[model samples]
Target: MQISQQDVHQALERGEFVPHFQPIIRLRTGQLYGFEMLARWAHPELGLIFPGDFIEQAERDGWISELTYQLLRKGLKEIAPLPGEPTLSVNISPPQLHGTSFVDQVHEAAAEANFPLNRLILEITESALAEDIVSVSKTVQSLKIAGCRLALDDFGTGYSSLLHLQSLPFDELKVDRSFVSSMTQKHDSRQIVAAVVGLGQSLSLTTVAEGVETEEQAEILLWLGCELGQGWLYGKPVPAEQLDEMMKRRQPHASNAILNGMTGRQSATALEIPPMQRFAQLRAIYDGAPVGLAFLDREMRYLSINRRLAAINGSPMEEHLGRTVAEMIPEFFPTVRPLIERALAGEVVAGVELTKPTQNPKELRTILLSYEPAFDESGEVIGVSVVLLDITPIKRAEEAQRESEAHFRHMIELIPQIPWIIDPEGRALDVSQRWLELTGVNDDQWRGFAWLDSLHPDDRQPTIDAMHRSFQSGEPIDIYYRVRRSKDHPWQLLRSRGSARRDDNGEIMCWYGSLEIIGESDAGKK
Candidate 1:
């Protein structure tokens, strides 16, 4: 539904409007990077509304400038408390740019919040500028001179061309999310990415691929020479609290996971960003390559590596290239040395999972690796192409799963009463056969769907609703409901206590609860 200007003004007056931030990554380094400020509205009545819904209406009603001002003002104030100065990209509407004093207002907002002008990236779309080149150019120049970086957002889908590129004084180009989103499935999309990267380089401007959704696409963009990227592949738009926590964490796992999700279904090509002349030639031939290739000098210093190789190494090409293995990462020497030595000895090493430590403790304590020798034309060993795969998170996840299982069993065994774990849907994940034996129910009747059938029909709805509320609100829950042994038996009280598991963003991922027979204890007290 379209929101009226009065609604927009009222929401603004009531302080319902706010900015949501999405991260922008330095394609090479998987670090806690910059953010883009996206507008959001939390209407008292509408509940939650996206910027697309009301922003244009506000713009059309001559309140676009005020909205833009509010967004920038809010964005700067929120970022003021962050540990380090973070780059913030704020969207600029066409109307806001038309005013002669808009640039000055931007300066005023930055000064008001004591924010650094250099940290602000004013993102304007190509379509927005297409209609009035003269005014847009003036606005762009004004923003640039004020030390605010200008970015041409959504470059490919609109009126994008060499002329627009030449006329606009933008320091960055955000390749549209549409192209980045489809890069995995569409061959034409990949071609478009390659073209944009090439154009960005020739223009001497930083190219940021938006909507990078997969490890494969990130690898391809790096190979195609893109320097930066932003998307769900990197991270979804988050609130100030989440973004601050991410910065505090100083890692981008969630962001990277988002990026990986974008390209999960597409075939990934390994990037060859290494300077090695030989590896460069090999990269042209390897389509949808599975193996990671890298070239090291005599001292085992990395000279060049492909995107696959970099992913194997734990970063993007820009961050990995031009640095020695020891310089980029010294801990790898422990596991990497033996393999390098083997390659130097004219032997090909294979299938070995070498563990290398990362300087950052948050980065898995160690990295796993494998490698092969890069032989010269004379078949003489030169350098080793080290292939690193980060199995740390996976390994930790497995370990956590095992520990959870052990803990679950211990909790079940320790409790004298029948114990069971149930999910949000009130379906049992684990249940003790003791409860089944007490009720004379077969093991088959106690698992999964059958277990839910045991809940007394009169009490089931309330219990299920309580569990759903817990899952939705992320609140601790305890419910006492009745379970029937059979149609002939009286129902017994079952008390369940549970909590929700959420991701870093505070979204509920799953809910787990444990049930205990409370009837006996209540009877003893009575």
Candidate 2:
């Protein structure tokens, strides 16, 4: 059914176009990261109307830009003074993004709402990139320059998603719900979601899964390394007033129930079941869990082991059963014995990282272990439940990163001048040791646009504007500024030059630059 253009315009005029907010959760910590504002039409006669009911009509009528601006302004204003001041994400259609004045309108709305531009995220659907890529890219760049983050919504649904990702500057990618909802039922869907999560991680983008409705879906998403999630399981989109109440009452661990496999509320229900049925349910959960799980007797012998734990031990389930730590893996038995004793004594032993000798002698594996005591009806500890997580890959990644940083530091220290690196967005990534020594600033002081604080007060804004322009244009930078040698000293003039470091695809990865001391009078000459 098609809606008349006049109806949408009339609704807009009556202030009926409002925003409903759905929370986006960070899966790693299960905390509220932000919210996505969805447009809703609170019609008097027709009851509440969704965006789908009128958005297409509004777009065809050439008033989608106006509708978007209204929604953006309302959403920002409602969320700006939120208790924690969480980030607000507002959607924009392709037409709006392609419009000549869209970026200006966004800035104006943000200003009117007294919202910080950096705390706002503008989301464009993947399908919107089907046409006018160049125009959309220009608008996106301008919005980023004004300090609003960009997110590609419903990312995997588009035909040219890879192309859009390559050409655009998206800080976040929201995986479409079609894949997330079917992941458990379809093997191929699971693979696709995993791949998208991996792709986002590689590109340094936050990956969010949308339309999650079940704990199972959320658990799978967490296992796939997706950073954030949105769906009914977290909460349905509600009006600003209800959302405010929800935010205030939301507990940090509320959304993490799936991460722990079940919540206390669910556990209470489980206790009401018949003993046989409860055991069956528990067995199913244990077998299906992604991490290693084992049940140990007071004597520290394995009574039951899940497939994951068996695989990690490089042994079959039968072999692990009735075997003590010393009998199975003698090399690390001394280290494991104390942890088992502690758990049996009703104390939780967690976050213990153990380097154990695997079946392959040449390779040592890193494993993280946690133990929880199981209690009887009398409240006496009967046994222990052990969770073992293989963290070899994570440890290896950390080691490799340290080595890479050390190598880069050595190379930078060799240079006599102060060097720095900034990402494509002009946020500082690293600075040379000479920079810290000369400015009398610590490493923390030089990270993420904080390097600007080291500059003389008068030269800061001009330098920032010049760098922003250079970043947008991919041009070489040559500027002179004054820097303080120390807190007690006067400012000294310095010249800095930088060039864009492009990838094989000719996209700017970062800006590499160095600073050299010039004559004190050089600042005046410039």
Candidate 3:
């Protein structure tokens, strides 16, 4: 039998949504790490309805947030009280990250369930992260700040780049199941899996190999350095009741069984944590690349260098040690000499700005350069330890975001109808100049609930009621309200329509609306 959208809607109203837990395993020890909670509909007539059928439709119908919240609540209910405080990974939708009050709703949901935020892992897709990364990144950062971890799902499936990984924070990297299922049969897929694992190791991200259906795939992934695996080989997704029993029966594979569900935030912000403590793992994986590391003698001659720094400086690692910094790159030596001098003088210099050569010579790479004075056992200065993390993409992303915001504001101003924005609570956030010009009020006078005072006496109460109804129902507001052009002028009929901007949890974060004079060609012209 075919299922209609209405069937799905009714299922949600009757509280039919439930969480199905899939096992994620720690590869090295064959121990269970955590479960990824997937959403399912327990239809009275149709049995468990999977998300692939209804999730997109829900989002299209503007009710995905409701679905997300219900699943989150049900999932939290199932696991929050379990022993060992097992980590739970939940997939977050794109719309929730883009405009919905996802950040606030998540914190609220976890708090309501008395769940620990650190044990929560939010899995985001690469495609979603690529869409409007600037806005999504801010929302993601807020989640990170709240102690929630993030995982980048479907590692090689979308248009993700090394830059995307560096700019947006992620705690775990999942090699998409397609690669794992095909790795043994396809050479390219195996190489991709190996590369992703290396990327994860370099960035201190816990790599989880997905869709490992066979022992051979698991062994190959483990050999490729992936620490986690999730698929039928471990166990298929089951109801929470079964999961609870499994959790109780299973002991940690090793005394130090890897809890790979969550890891620390991996981003430039990680730099704020003590350099040595933060970079210790990074230094150990010096061969993995991403960051450039090197050591120079007191005379500024290269003593040791990693392959990445050698490639970056357009020189071989062996040649780097024999040649002095000036001899290797005379162009950059002048700018770096001062910072090097400071390190040699026993001063630890950090965040020293430096430029690097990119493929496009016109566009130089931005480097967050740090230099620390290396010391001997006797406390005498030996050399300078250098760490160069390229941040050019991050800088370029910021510039692009600024330009996009300017364009958005310009577009908002150009529309004929008067545009305005409001907080979820109905307080004015922005009232376009057009509204002010027509009303003969300054921007300050037009903002906040004070604008309600200018409504025609008879329309004020009705307008307030309409706003409340819309805010309460998460529906669009549309009404013919009357407002005076001036205190002395007669009331003019206006058509206003606004809708709630919801986060993934069905919580309103803000409202966007526009106003038009009923008879006038343009609100501003009138």
Candidate 4:
């Protein structure tokens, strides 16, 4: 029988939504790292409902947050009784990452369960990163402050995955199951897995391969320097009641005893090459970076610099070595020296803007400076690694945009008709001063659907219908409306025309329109 949405809602209240565990094993050591908790519906009439059947439905019905908290509570209660600090990973839906209560609720659940936050892992999918990234970032920071770990689930599936990896404080990068499962047969899949592992190694992140079902896959992942695996080969996701027995059955012998068919010491030694390869890749990335990269010694002399940085300094890369910043780029030196000094003092710095004059007298160049403290083996601050991004273009673009907007507003004041702009969804983006003056209101009051409030009551419905038709047809709309400056002023007939602002592809980017008074209203004649 197909279940109605109500059935799932009731199931949640009845506490039918529970967590199941899947083991994540350390590939190199063959030791159990943790258990990833998955949600299952323990329905009385139905045997068990997997997350696939109801996860999206819960999100759509606006209960994903509650469902997630329920799972966390149930899973924590079940896992608290287990031995050791084995991690418990739970998937966080996109909705749960937003709003105010998510972090507080999780803190409440963990506190009530008496589970250590360090061993709790919250897995987030790449898609979640796209929605309110600021919220996601704040959530990550808060969870980290609480000593909880975060995993980027299904890595490499999204376009901005790499950017997220750079920006967010993620503890784990999960290799998507599709790549892990296809590694043995598809060369591209295997390469992708290797690249992800290599990337994780470079970033010092624990890389986990999902859906590893065969020995060959594990072998390849281990060779690629990926140390964690999760899938059927380790064990299917099982109920918490069955966990203790499984743990006992799978406990490592002789402290993670060597797996069969491999010389343990040799296998461990062979894993060394990937790190060297990873370092080489990291170096290549550093050298070819779009921004300027350099290392400044304690004395503020250039220890190393990339070609891009050299180009920015108007000097050769090799020539930059052993020269003080003051000697190399006299103009840039004074501005950046203080930031480098801070890093040399063991303080990391970022986003310190440095502005200098370019060769052209009229132009100024701006670079965003970020510095990392380099440390020696003895734990002393050795030098500073500096990253300089020339953001002059972005700054210039922003300035030019501001000037353009000012110019547009000036032109709008000079025009006889009131001008307006709206997004494709009909949300008012901008309206001219004329409209605001005529309506005896501010533009803020007319944003979104509220713009209809300014129209004469009878004309509002007709205007909406006309806009709908125009949007649907992607055509110009010519319509009439009635409005007055105030209740004391007689209503006047106005002509409004709006047309789609199309791009090169003929896709509507927004709607631009103008309104003008054509005649006095019927009420004024009366």
State which candidate has the highest lDDT: 4
RMSD of each: 26.8, 30.5, 32.2, 27.7
Tell me which residue pairs clash in candidate 3: 100-502, 100-503, 101-503
Over 112-164, each residue of candidate 3 has an lDDT whose tens digit, in order, gives: 99999998999999878877999898889999999999999998888856767
Give a tens-digit lDDT track for model 4, residues 1-526: 3567788679877998888999898787777888999999898987898989888878887888888989999898888777767889999998888866889988999999999899898999999999889988888888889899999999999869988989988999999999988777776787788899889987888999999888777777776778788888888999978988897898542112235465666655655556767578878998989999998888888888899988878889988999998999887777777877888889999999878778998998888889999864224676889888999999999999999999988987997888888888888888888887788777588888788787888888898898889999998989998887788877778899988999999989999989987977766332
Report the lDDT tens digits of candidate 2 across residue range 1-526. Answer: 5777677668879999889999988665567888999999898998888888778878887888888888888998898888777889888887888766888888888999999999999889977888888888888888989999999998777789999989988999988999998887776788789889888877878888999898778767775668788898888999987976898787764334443676645543543344456578889999999899999988889999999999988789999899887888787788889989999999999999988776789988999999999864224677999999999999989999999989988987887677878898879897777877778888788889888888888789999888888988889988888877665666778899999999999999998998887755434322
Which of the numbered candidates is closest to the native, going by highest TM-score? 4
Per-residue lDDT tens digits for candidate 1, residues 337-440, read: 76778877777776665555567655544345556776542245667766655566777899899999889877777776665666556566667766775566
Which ten contiguous residues of candidate 2 have the minimum total lDDT? Answer: 267-276
Q: Global CA lDDT of candidate 1, please?
A: 0.72
Question: Which order, best to worst by TM-score?
Answer: 4, 2, 1, 3
Cand. 4 TM to true fold: 0.51
TM-score of each: 0.49, 0.50, 0.49, 0.51
Query: Between the candidate structures 3 and 4, which one is better when assessed by TM-score?
Result: 4
**lDDT-based ranking:** 4, 2, 3, 1
lDDT of 4 at 459: 88
Q: Identify the runs in model 1 with alpha carbons over 4 angstroms from their true place.
A: 253-526
